[model samples]
Target: YPAAPQRFSCFGFDDVNAALAAMRFIHASTPPTELYLRVYQLESRQLPRRSELRPPVRSSPCDCGFVGNQDDEDENFLAIARAMEEIVDDRVDCYWLIRCFVNQFKHKFGDSIPHL
Candidate 1:
């Protein structure tokens, strides 16, 4: 993670041993807000389609097709985050979080193109 105020509770590692280090950082008395376990190759292969995931429209109720109303859309995301936090100890799944981030990016800037 970064440092101090900018330090993130979430972590990403390419191997199992690094992930084990992260586990030790978490204390039973005061666990992190969330944890994420990711295999870069696997997630790269299963990237979510940009068109299928878009940001919630705060202005127009029907602009975003995922939910009928804006309030419901916000609630849904909060619920998902809460669920992820609850399962941090059991399993750290970063797929959904990464997908959501990509979707938000694409929603603002059309399709994403990788650059070497």
Candidate 2:
């Protein structure tokens, strides 16, 4: 069967800052309990370079263990993997999980996102 048609409203702005401002205004006026913002770039431009005169450094031949132990990092990653496995085992929809994560991220970092 053909996919169901999707309808969405699109707004254009001269720059990202303008778009973000519009979004903030809309969000404040009609504050939805749940909302997700997805921004897409219509055009791309090469950024101007400031300075470039550094040569690549070569690695030493001797084996040196400069890096510290990563057991804690590894355990943390393993714990996350286990939790994800459990969620999958519960048959949670992947799209729902992604949407939940995106909403959480927006709630946590929405204000700071424009800086990034």
Best-performing candidate as measured by TM-score: 1
- Error at 112, model 2, angstroms: 0.6
Encode model 2's per-residue lDDT on 50-103: one tens digit a residue: 253121122332322222223322222233333444555321232234345545
Q: Residue 114 in candidate 2 has what lDDT?
A: 38
TM-score of every model versus the real structure: 0.25, 0.23
lDDT of 1 by residue, 1-116 (tens): 34532222234332432543454532344222222221321344532233543333234322333333434434333444455565544233433464465457447643322210
Residue pairs with clashing backbones, model 1: none
The stretch of ten residues in a row with the least summed lDDT in candidate 2 is 33-42
Model 1 earns a TM-score of 0.25
| Residue 26 alpha-carbon offset, candidate 2, angstroms | 26
